[model samples]
Target: MRGYAIRKAMQPHRLTLKVWAVAGSFFGSLCFVLFQGGKLALMLFVIVSILSIYLLLGKWSGIRKTAGSRQLMNAEHETTIEAGSSLNVSMHLQIPGIWPIPYVFVKERLFHKNNTEYTYEVTLVPDWKRRGIFEYKTHPLRRGFYTFGKTECVTEDIFGLFEHTGYIELPQQVAVLPQIVPIREWHQFHQMMKGTNHHSTTTRAVRETTQINGVREYIYGDRLSRIHWNATAKTGTWKSKEFERESLPKTFVVLDRHSQGYTEDEQFELAVSVCASLFHYGASRSFALGLVSGGAASQFFEPKHGQQHLKAVTQHLIGVEADGTYPLRRILKEYVQNVAPGSFVTVISPEHGESMLAVLHWLKQLQLNPCHIFVSADPQRKEHWLKSLKSAGFVGYAVSSLAELPVMLGGRS
Candidate 1:
C-alpha cells in the first residue's frame, strides 16, 4: 500500500534527477576552470556544487515527507444543498513547520460517478495567522453524491531549479439532493385527510402486520425468531423474517419522452430525480418500488423494496438517457405490458395529449390510476399540464425544480 501510495504521489510530476546532476557538474567544472586550475580551488568548487545539489534534494524530500504525514482536520464533511443551489466546501490544512514561501499551488482531486474527474486549483498566500481556509463553490450541475480525495500542493524552490510538491490524503464528500421531490408524505396526507377526509389509496390488499416486509438472508446481528426455517433449508443459509408492508405504497414511475422536448441533460436529470423521490418515499413506507423509462435506452426494474434495490436503481438512474428517436407510444406500450399488475404507475414528463392518452390507456389496462407528475421547465406550461391532467381523471402536480420534490414528499399541503 505504501509503495502504491508513493508511486501515485510522485506520478503527477515529471521528475528527472539527471537535470540536477548535469547542473551540479556544469557549476563544478566552471568553478574549476575559472580558479586558475589550482587544486585547492577546484576541490572547493566541487564541494560547493555537491552541497547545492544536496540542499535541493533535501528540500524536495522534506516536502514529500510533510505531505505524506499531513492530516486533514475533517475526515468527512457533508453539506446538503438543493440541486442547482451553490454549495461551498471549506477545508483546513496544517503542517508541522511553515516554509517561509509565499506562493504555493493547492489543488483538490474530485471523482464523479459519471466516470469524470474534476481538479480544483487555488493559490495559497502566506498568512501570519498560520491557518487559512480554502473554500470551493460549485453550482451542482447534477444531483447525487460526489467525492474528493488525494489533494496535492505544488511549489518550486526560490531558485526555480527544483520543485517540491505535497499531498494531503483527506477524504471529502458532498451530496447534492434532487432539485425537486414530488409528493411528500405530509402533502399526501393532507391531500387525503384534508377537509372532507378521504382515505389514502395506497393501502395494501392484505390486512397483514405492517412490520413484516419479506424473508431475506440473515446477517450476523439478526434475531433468531426472525429466521425462516423453510427458506433457510431451501437457500442453504439463514433467512430472516422480512417485513412486507413496512415500505411506503408501491409506486411504478414511468417517463414519457415522445413530446417532452428536453435537451439530453434535462431529460436525464428529470428521470434521475423522479426515481430518487420514489425510492425515498418507498423506503419511508417500506413499500416496493419500480421504475420504467421511455426512449431508445428503455429500462424496467420489477417492484421490490429494500435498501439494496434502492442503491441498485439509483446507480442506473444517474446514467439513464433518452435517445429521443423512437415514438413515445412504443415505450408506453412496452411499459404497459411489462409493469406489474395493480402497482401504482406514475408517468413523469412535460408532454401531454397523445402521449398522455396512450399512457392513460396502458395504466387503465393494468387497473392502475397511474398519476402524472409533470416537471415543466416553464412555469406557465407546467400549470397548463396540471389542469389538463386534472380534467382527464388523473391527479397532477407541477414541479418547477428538483428542490421542490422533498417538499412534496414531506406531505406539505
Candidate 2:
C-alpha cells in the first residue's frame, strides 16, 4: 500500500465521563481501604485500577499506531457523462495495521458549480488486512461541472470511548454535458435565406477534395480508393484517408445569458441545449461553427471545424451560468466585429421585444443572415414571438425543451 502523510497533530484519546467516574470510585475505595483497613476493599481497588489502566492504554496505543500506518484511498468514476444521468463512484481504502477495528465510517461529499453540496455516509467493515471497498450511485445530476471533496474515514474503539479520523484528498471532477437533440434536417436556415444572393455561398453538404487531410477509422460506406494501406497494415485495422473539404459556410451561435430574460433556471438551460444542438448539427455536416456567450465573462470562438474546436465549445457550455450584465442588443453590438458578412448568425434568447427585433435588423444590414430562437415554456408567448419574427422576414424557432427542437427545425422526433 502507498504511504499517506498522517495529520501531524492527532487528536488525543478522549476519556468519556465513565472513565472519570471509575477513577473516582477507585479513589473512594482506596480511602475506605486505608481508613477502615478492609481487606476486601483493598483487593477490589487493586483489581479495578489494573483493569482500567489496561483497557485505556490498550485502546489508546492501538489508535496511535493505526494513525501512523500506511494508508491510501482511490476513487473511480467517469470523467464525463451526459446531463440528467446518474453517476457511479467506487472507493477503495487500504490501511495496513493489525489493530482490531470494528468499523470505519465513510463520508463523501459532491460539490456542484453553484455551491450546492450532496453528502453520503456509509459504514465500512475492514477486512483482516484493514482494507475496505465501497460503491455508491448519485441521483440524476444536471448539466454542470461537479467535483468530489475530501473523503473522511472515521473509526472509533469498540466501547466508543476514543475516535480517530483520517482524510483522503481526491482531486477529481466530472463534466455533465448539456443535452443534445439530434436534428435530421435543418430547413429553417435555407428556407429563410431563400431567394437571397448569399444563399449560393451557403454549403449544403461536405464537398471533398483530393488533398489528404488525415487518416481516420474506415467507415462502412467509404470507397476503397480512399484507403490508407500503410496505416492499415501497421495498425492492423482498416484506415481511410480523409480529404480536405471546400470552404465551409460559417455559422455562429450566440447565446444570451442576461438574468432578466429568464424567469427560471430551466429556461436558460433550454437555451443552452438549443445552442449545443445547433453546434452538433453543424459539426456533423462539416460546417464551420463558432460560439459566442455574452455573460459576466464573455467568450468568443471564431468559426472553425475540427474535433478540438468542438470539444472546447462543449467544455465551455458545461460550466456556463446566467450572469450577463448587458442585454442582447448591447452584447451583439459589442461583438459584431467578429462576425463575418454573409455568415449565418443564430441568436438564442428568451427576449423577443422591439430591442431584439432591432438587433436582428441591424445584423441583416451588416450583410449577416440573422435568425431568432426564442426559448420559453409559455405557449402564448411563443406564438406571439414567432409571429412577430416571421413578419420581420427572419427565421424563428421556439423551444421549451430539448425534445421539441427536432420537430421545430423540420425534423421528426
Candidate 3:
C-alpha cells in the first residue's frame, strides 16, 4: 500500500516525462525531415505532432463533462461490531458514460477520531455496463468510531498520458465498540458494599414486591408464599411466582477520560473496555446501569435497565475519546451532585495518583460507595496502585487486559 501511494504521488511526474518524450520525438522527426529529406521522416513528424496534440487536448476534451456527470458510489459494511473483529467493506461504482476506460483506481480512506487513518487502494475494471464492484476485508479493528472519506476514482487515458480523477462521497460510518468480557458475577460489588446503608446486591435479587410479574419453574430456595399454585396445577410441576422487585440502586461506571492520566491509547482503551463490560453485566442482570465520562465533552447516561438504554450507552462508548482537559477529581466534583446518595460509583481509570484518591474520599463523604478499577500496562505499577487504593480503605481492582477482567471482578470467563 505504501508503494502504491508513492507511485500514485509520482504519477504527475510520469505524465510530465511522457509529455517531454513526445515533444522530443516530434522535434527529432522534424529535424530528420529537414536534414535527411526523406518521406518517412516527414510522415513521422506529421504523425508525432498530430498524436501529441490529440493526446494533450483531444483525449481530454470531454473529461470535464465525464467527471461532472452524475457518478454513483456506495460503500456497504457492518455499521457496528465488537472490538477485535474484522470488518468487510463492499464498494460499488457506476460511471455515467461509456468512455472506454481501461480500468479505474479506487482509493478508500478510514479516519479515526484521533486523526489516525488507514488507506486502501483497489483497481476495478469496468464492464461493458460501466459499473464495477470491489470488496475487501479489514484486519481486526480496535474500539473506535471510524468514518470513510470520499472514495477517489482515477482513470487514465488508454495511452496512459493523462489522468482524470473524480471523487464520490461515501459517508459510511462504522463503530467498533469496546470488547465485553463475560462476567458471571461481580463479587466485589457485593463484598465491598455489604454493610452499606443502601441495599446493594450483585444481581436483581433485592426484596421482592407483592406484584407478581410472571411465573417460572420453582427454584429450590423459593419461599412457600411465592409458590404459584395455578401454574403448578396447569403444568403438573412445581412453579414459583416471579415478582416485580424494587429497582436496585443505580450503578454508575465513571470512565476516566483525562488525557494526562493515560500513557498510551491502549490504556484508555482498556479502561473503556472495563466500563463496557460492566455495562454488559448490568444489562444482562437487569441492573440500573449508567455511564459517566468527563471528557472534552462530558456525557452522562441516566441509570436505566433496558436494551434501548444499553444501546445508547454502547453508542456513546464507540465514539468516546480521552480528550478531557480536567482531571477526574475536578470533573467528578462538578457532576457528583447528579448522582444520588447510596449509589455505587465505579471509577475506571489508569490514574492512581493522589488526585484519584481524593476523588474516592470525596465520593465516600457523599455517601456513595466508590470502587476503583485501575487500568495500567506495567504490572509492578498496577500492583503498587492497587495496594495504595486498598490501604486507603477503597475497593480497587487492577486489570491489564479484557481477558483478566472477569477474574479480577470475581467472575469466570
On lDDT, the leading prediction is 3
lDDT (C-alpha) at residue 388 in model 1: 76
* Candidate 3 residue pairs in backbone clash: none
Query: How do all the candidates rank in terms of lDDT, highest first?
Result: 3, 2, 1
Each model's TM-score, in the order given?
Answer: 0.59, 0.77, 0.76
Taking the tens digit of each residue's C-alpha lDDT, what string does model 1 give over 285-345?
5666777766666777777868888767766555455555666556666666655454567
Q: Which parts of model 2 are misplaced by more than 4 Å?
A: 1-19, 25-77, 190-245, 411-413
TM-score of 1: 0.59
Query: What is the RMSD, in Å, between candidate 3 and the native fold over all Cα?
Result: 5.9
- Estimate the lDDT of model 3: 0.78
Better candidate by TM-score, 2 or 3: 2
Position 263, candidate 3: lDDT = 88
What lDDT score belongs to each candidate, Candidate 1 first?
A: 0.61, 0.77, 0.78
> Mind sharing the TM-score for model 3?
0.76
Model 1, C-alpha of 393: deviation from truth (Å)? 2.7
* Candidate 1 minimal-lDDT segment of 10 residues: 189-198
